[model samples]
Target: MAEPHPVLITPEWDAPATVRALCTTRHGGVSTGPWGEFNLALHVEDDSAAVAQNRKSLLKACDGLEQIQWLNQTHSPRCITADGNSLPEADAAETDHAALACAVLTADCLPVLFCDETGSQVAAAHAGWRGLLDGVLVNTVKQFRAEPETLHAWLGPCIRQPRFEVGAEVRVAFVERFVGPSRAEIENCFSAAGEPGKFLCDLATLAALQLRALGLSRVSDCGLCTVDDPRFYSYRQHNPCGRFASLIYRLP
Candidate 1:
């Protein structure tokens, strides 16, 4: 007789009072089977009606959101300003409008939330390896009207290094571009996996390094690994899995 209260990860940072941010875990929704509770994405072909209800529960939890400006994330370096209209094909979305949440969905990949010191703007980005290496966070930072020092970024749950094995090429692609002190930092992001020509990559560390390079000293990480943490969905664990969302917005 009562709606399931969705379990959300609220960022514990020094963001302004008006700035609100949250990440959903795989708890408290109507989807059955592998989706098992709060799955918010509609594109995975989980029953459309169930997904719709999950979203509705999400909406109820936020209450008064004009819209959750969602993107059709494509692992590209694309970031856009959310207009509260149609869903755009981008890895990131930002909005200055009050009550409109900028949103991105993810399973194993990173979900990054951003807000300015003044709480006047907010953004969300989806950063898979390709998107991260291709500069999706770069594009997201560009959308901010404030200087990098005035911004705060919160990195959400993702596949951590020990659980995220990748080929040597992934390591090369990330480390080769940097040759200074930063190069060593990048190199440290990976460790040789048990198998040859493979390395365990740390997506969150890479994201933080990139963010810090972009001049955001205020970056914070939720320190959650989706694969190791049973509360969130993991694409590597189950294909066609549900996607949890990372959302941020300014209050009206």
Candidate 2:
């Protein structure tokens, strides 16, 4: 059974009054078993009717949100401009349209919400390790009409550094993006795990670094970890877990 009221985490950045952003927690919905309740992703094998009902409830919970309008999220760097109705094959989405939210679904993967300093546009990106390494955030940033320096971003909950163990190959791949002293900063985001050839990666810090590199000075986070925090879902902790959302939109 779903909770009477769904819990939402609003970003604590300095965005203008015209822009709004939030991330959903796994506390409201009607899926059973591992999905339990509050499961938002339909592709996770949750009951179709229940999922639809949950989605409807989500719309009702959100004051003027028109729809979630999920992307196919292929883990590629693809980002698309959305119109609030078309489901596209991309990992990120952006829009200036009011009431039509841009959203990304995630379990353990990082979901990022973005908006211009003046609140003219907004975007959401699903950044799994692959997508993050592949520049999904970069592509999402490019969709904004505002300069990178004029953007504010909020990092949603995900598997944090202490629990996000990655192979050496992943670290090597990410390191390849940098070449000098800046590379050391990126390298600091990955610490050696107790296990040989494994490293614990700080997904949020890594994301913040990339955003800073892009000139976005106002990056903030929910400061929560998905696997350790029951408020959000974690695919690493529950392999068949449901996905939650991080979303943004303009208000008319």
Candidate 3:
């Protein structure tokens, strides 16, 4: 039998050979309408059976991946070690174990994948605006005992700056976290949305900034916008949409 060619995205980074990663697109599954196909998330009203089948397809695409340690993300800064069992209620997870996938589900939210230069550790974080401002990326990086300079990060599809209009409080939330010269850097992530109190936020840029702030120099972005790209799911574009999965694991 021929291998199924489901639409998957590989990160463009100089990661070690043992680290494997991919992001699923909304194609090649048994879902219908809003969920379309390949909807891996179960919390978005997608059919349970369809979600199961889609998840199975994802695992198949990973080849030897034993299991994807899924998280019940709540836009918090909590991160846990990926143990291959027990779905933890956290926004990020990391693991140094081979064949154990650390994964996160996202529609418009930014999904960041991490791995060290030696491929001994890998992690995935779901960073919505709230989670980003709350330090989810920082928490994920902290899990790896390796030096931050030795890590590589990949920023996945998310709502772009032009479409991510946020209230003044959203801008304030991030700005309040920085001080002096650093405040200007965080403030640059937001631009006026033409409304009095609204601003356009670049989620990927913000995530990259966070990664760089943690001493990670090699950060690459997929540059795919979930809201503008038809291949991926976008909650901002389709209200009751499903989520795509960004997963990373080590090869044994």
lDDT of candidate model 3 versus the reference = 0.89
Error of 1 at 216 (Å): 0.8
Write the residue-wise lDDT of candidate 3 on 1-252 in tens digits. 643456998889899988999999998877888998888888998899988888887887787798889889899999999898898899999999999999999999999999999999999999999988888999999999899999999999999999999999999988997322278888898999898999999888888887887899999998999988999999888889988999999998
Candidate 1 colliding pairs: none
Candidate 3 residue spans exceeding 4 A from truth: 1-5, 178-181
In order of TM-score, best first, we have 1, 3, 2
List clash counts for every candidate, in order: 0, 2, 0
Q: List the global CA lDDT of all models.
A: 0.89, 0.85, 0.89
lDDT of 1 by residue, 80-171 (tens): 98997898899999989999999999999999999999999899999999999888898999999999889999999999988999999989
Q: Model 3 misses residue 105 by how many Å?
A: 0.4
Give candidate 2's error at residue 165 in angstroms: 0.4
TM-score, cand. 3? 0.96
Per-prediction TM-score: 0.96, 0.95, 0.96
Query: What C-alpha lDDT does candidate 1 achieve relative to the native structure?
Result: 0.89
